[model samples]
Target: MEIKFGDAKYYAYTGTHDPASDLESVVFVHGAAMDHTVWAHQSRYFAYHGYNVFAVDLPAHQFSRGELLLSIERMAAWLNQVIDQTVGTAFHIVGHSMGALIALEAAANFNHPDAGLNSLSLIGFSYPMSVTPQLMDAAQHNPSEAYSMMTQWSHASAIGGEPVPGFWSAGMQLSMMENSTAGSVHTDLIACDNYAGGEAAFVKVTCPILFLSGMRDKMAPAKLAQAEADKNNNAAIVLLPDCGHSIMSESPDGVLNELKRFIGARK
Candidate 1:
């Protein structure tokens, strides 16, 4: 169903839970260039288990209101509003790719006074340190070049032990291109490029986090992600063999298993 929050409508698969209960909701955030469709399997699975699921499309992305503003903080702030309106209060955050960055930002700023949060899961992402200045500049000057750079990083292999076509995922890439203004990428590359606290912030993430990565991931590239993991002490980094960067689509089973463990363990 759709929850009208702020200026946009958030698409979620929420379960029946008392609105007054401190019972938290699960909000799934999608990565850059992708919409809420990627989490179709996960949202359906979670809703089956009585968990309130809110799989929302971020502002500036398709199926959502507002212009495509590339600021991560702006997206996070809008997301915060969604949280307040949809299921006021406690929540569990699950972010993939760029959405993982949003989860981090939300966890950093979350101050649910009524009660504490449930847990957080970061999937299909490593760290932002992988992006180089040249890539950042390319995305700003010529988005096609940036799009190419992103294409180069996308993991195209399938989790079902089959090879998936690159064109299958081209729609997401195309969305990025169409949403972008100024004839360049929509977002400010500098935000990702200038993400400070590279090492220390991982420590600040006191919540239990699950870092899902593909063995063949090119974007967060497994090696660089490992380097970043050297900094996160409370995180569990799982590597999927023969898989690419697209963990949700590649290994729905693996993703489901990890999520079940993460959510089940809380009880």
Candidate 2:
């Protein structure tokens, strides 16, 4: 479904039901060079099981319009707009990779008179998400090469675990990145690299946080994720064995179960 946030129209994957009438809403944010479909498995699950799901496509990504926000701060602002325009109040937030950083910023810094962030789930996240120079250069001059590097580093093995039979996870992710607007990958990489507010932002978070990491994650390893989790006294860290950075696709059931448990306890 498309909703108007200022002049920009945002696309959200609402699955079989709309969130217009639901009191409980969950917003899912995708990583850099990715779209709402990354939460396909979990969004559908929540939408039909008594919760409103807003799996959003970030600006200049897939079906969403407007130029890409180049910083985590701006992305958090966009997230606040999304919540205000849609649910209009408190809601649960889930984010992955770069999206996780955005969620953290939004939870810590964003303020809305009519709404508030209820809880946060950060999956495959890191504090100082430093992007390698080679990846940044590739994103600027050759996006295809950047996509290749991302695909390789985003999974546990060279051949990634698929969400379904005959559907290759790494290939699907590559296609999604390839479809992104020109220079978007570069902008996203720079955004993650330049973000310096993570530790500070995390310290200010008032809600319960769930930190989910993949033990085999090469991009954001379990140790790095645990370091971030350690700062939050209210955070519960779960490490999925054999999973990679793409936790939703690589270990959909595990991720969904953890989400169910976390959101259930809060609700």
Question: For each candidate, what TM-score against the reference?
Answer: 0.78, 0.95
Model 2 agreement with the true structure over 167-189: per-residue lDDT tens digits: 78888889999888888999999
Model 2 has an lDDT value of 0.87
RMSD of each: 4.0, 1.6
Residue pairs in collision within model 2: none
Model 1: which residue pairs collide?
A: 70-187
Clashes of 1: 1
Best by TM-score: 2
lDDT scores for all predictions? 0.65, 0.87
Across 58-90, the per-residue lDDT of candidate 1 in tens digits comes to: 665556656665556666676766776655345
